[model samples]
Target: DASGVEAVALALVINSGVTLVKTIPLRRFEDAVRFGIGLSPVFTVFQVDDQITSSPHIAGPTGDTRLMPDPSQTVGLVASPGWALAPVDQLDQDGEPYPGCPRTFARRMLERLAGHGLELRGCYEIEFFLGHRAAPGPDEADPTPAHTGPAYGAIALADVEPFATALIRAFEEQGTGVMQFHPEYSTGQLELSVPHSVGIAAADTDLVVRHTIRAVARNHGYAVSFAPVVFAERVGNGNHLHLSLWNRNGRNLFQGGRGPEGMTREAEAFTAGVLAALPALTAITAPSVPSYQRLQPHRWSGPWACWGRENREAALRFVTGMVGSRPDAANLEVKSMDPAANPYLALGAIVAAGIDGLERELSLPDPVQDDPASIPARKRRSLGIRQLPASLTEAIAELEKSPMLREAMGDVLFDSFLATRRAERDVFEGQDPEDVVRAHRWRY
Candidate 1:
């Protein structure tokens, strides 16, 4: 649904661009015509590579080639003679401002953070499912093993050795650091952690890693999904975003051994901002109907708006490694996000919200030592702890009310996204659960 919304938004922008920009030179058409008559329509997609390539047919029977950007060029061919001449790297479809372009939008938020003389860095740990590419029957059980080994077992290599080996190679080639891959609790589910990097590279590595996993898996006749739920009974997958902030002089902002919760004032404020914005950010972080199923309490998915040390049950987890561990290992792990989220949007929103907190000097609540899920209703209310969006419709409603997000993502793209998502919700909200799973479970 998010993908379709993106597509529709891009199409609208491209159409606007094509209308405003002058037509291609007549000579270019002549050149394309020379390729052959009855050939699929042809158009020159001026690419960053400084080359022009023509396709006889823009897309074959399958829409794969049509949606794929040219290998040598960054432009995607969406329709015959219609190409995405401008790379939507961080821009919108219309060559105008697009707040929805996660890359561009994240950079904007990062710049805002910089205005306060602070810097941010991030790392993403992705959990996913891998198994036979074939679809399973309704009553059929998935034959794939729960994992290659016990939880975090290095010895369970046999189950995912082939897949892991290829994943490692692809990550290396893509210039991404592969920290590790281990069997997770879910059947055939695996988690891969990447060495964290500063600023944009951290997000870039994540996007590349997702591409690498899918490509490597496809080559091996396996399908990999980053979906939150691949099966009802199994643990769902999640995309946990780990982040830390620092000052212009490179001081770790989240650390102040003598300060509140060992967090510096600035770090505390930033964390407060993110916590306050958590509900609204869910539209971009989780953003799917099925994602809510994974955010249930007691499932270890952070649903409550609170933070704690080494607490997996809290939305904002303050990870403290061993006594001898590097202090930088102390960072916030947001466990509410899922693979369905566009990394750019999620990162941007997190950064923006955190910046908001710092600018406003927001105060954070005391850490929840016991189970946040089991906290008394009165205590939870007193502390202002709230739950994340429980469904796509609710998530979108939250998103629609976010003035911060609307400002970060341009008015046009945001408006388009809202419209498209509302249309989709109208179509899919009340459908059969099994059919809903079948229709969208693997799409992301």
Candidate 2:
């Protein structure tokens, strides 16, 4: 084992966005990798709560698959000694890549884009809340924020300096790039973003980085929740996605072009496609019940299905970067998504929508300069800005209408994903917002 690693975690992300993992001892790693560890296909439709939902394509106890860890991207965990993490690909008994595999779906999307001489560089910006360990008792009080300083204040950074500092070291030592990490707008909530990676690695990084955070936090006697909403009243966390398009020759397509904010026709078309598909995309990116609480208007969560330059309220916020840095730094920020999403499936869906835009040569509408909701109704309608799906139910309905997204994910994946979503909706039906938020508090 490299670095005296004792075990390796074979991690897989299912349609429900939960990371289901199996670990193997170092001595057995070769056998596990070559022959794969058996896993049931029913996991494809597991709920966030671990309840299984059935799909016509893949369900029940009749099917099996193998989880083969990717050795190329395996890494020793600096935060958790004697361990390593490797993302896995699910292959059916026939040794064929399974249609229900989210990771494989993401790779296929990237391959599709590569065929057009294009590529994506993307990363996840994760926000999470930290809570102190709860005392054991029947009358145990509520878990308190690990830090009491004002939100986003310097005092907040100082309060959690020890844990935060360890977090930084863990990331650096593990070879994970840390672009920025700091206090966020909610009490005990912190946000960190890593440098973008090309292809499925970005999605892989999302899982490993989150694992590193949880391990370091436990060592510091704190609990971590990447859930959309930790409490009913508090502002929820965001898993904002930052992405950019580039060509094989290393040119940034988002800048130095004739379209809006120097976007090339391809870039503009891609943006338009994403904007038009926000309603449908939510079924993948913001799949949780409490996810709606974070997607509300005025939360700066970008509930409006529109775009603007550096506008946080816009679903797609275009960043031109600082003067003279446009070529290297330009990217788009998707503010509506949260950590509850499966990044692989989310990224693939986003790319699929963008591909549709490019194929149709779609044009982006005029950017929303103000909050779309605050604008006069007539003006908002004229600008073509509409609020995205308000609930998981509505988002699922929109997804049902999207043939493009369904085709992108294929029938097996598409059917199983919907099955899980519908199961979640039915399970949480009639639950109050506070109850819903609490149920999802530590799931991710």
Best-matching candidate per TM-score = 2
Model 1 lowest lDDT segment of ten: 11-20
Candidate 1 pairs with clashing backbones? 99-409, 99-410, 146-187
Could you give candidate 2's per-residue lDDT for residues 301-410 as a string of tens digits? 88989999988888899989999999989998988898899999999999999988988889998877787878988878887888899899999999999999999999
**Collision count of model 1:** 3
Return model 2's CA RMSD, one decimal: 1.5
lDDT of each: 0.63, 0.89
Residue 220 of model 1, lDDT score: 76
Per-residue alpha-carbon lDDT of model 1 for 1-444, expressed as tens digits? 111112111111110011011223233433322221111111112111122332222212322111111122222222212222212232222334333334566667888888899877888899888887555656544435535446666656576788788778766644566788777876777889988887766665565566567667777778787777787645788899998888877777777555556888888888899999888887667765667778878778888778888778888998765665536766889999887666766787899898888889998888887777688889888877777777779888888888977776666445544544454455557876555555455666
Model 2 misplaced regions, further than 4 Å: 135-141
lDDT for position 402 in model 2? 99
lDDT of 1: 0.63
Off by over 4 Å in 1: 1-100, 135-156
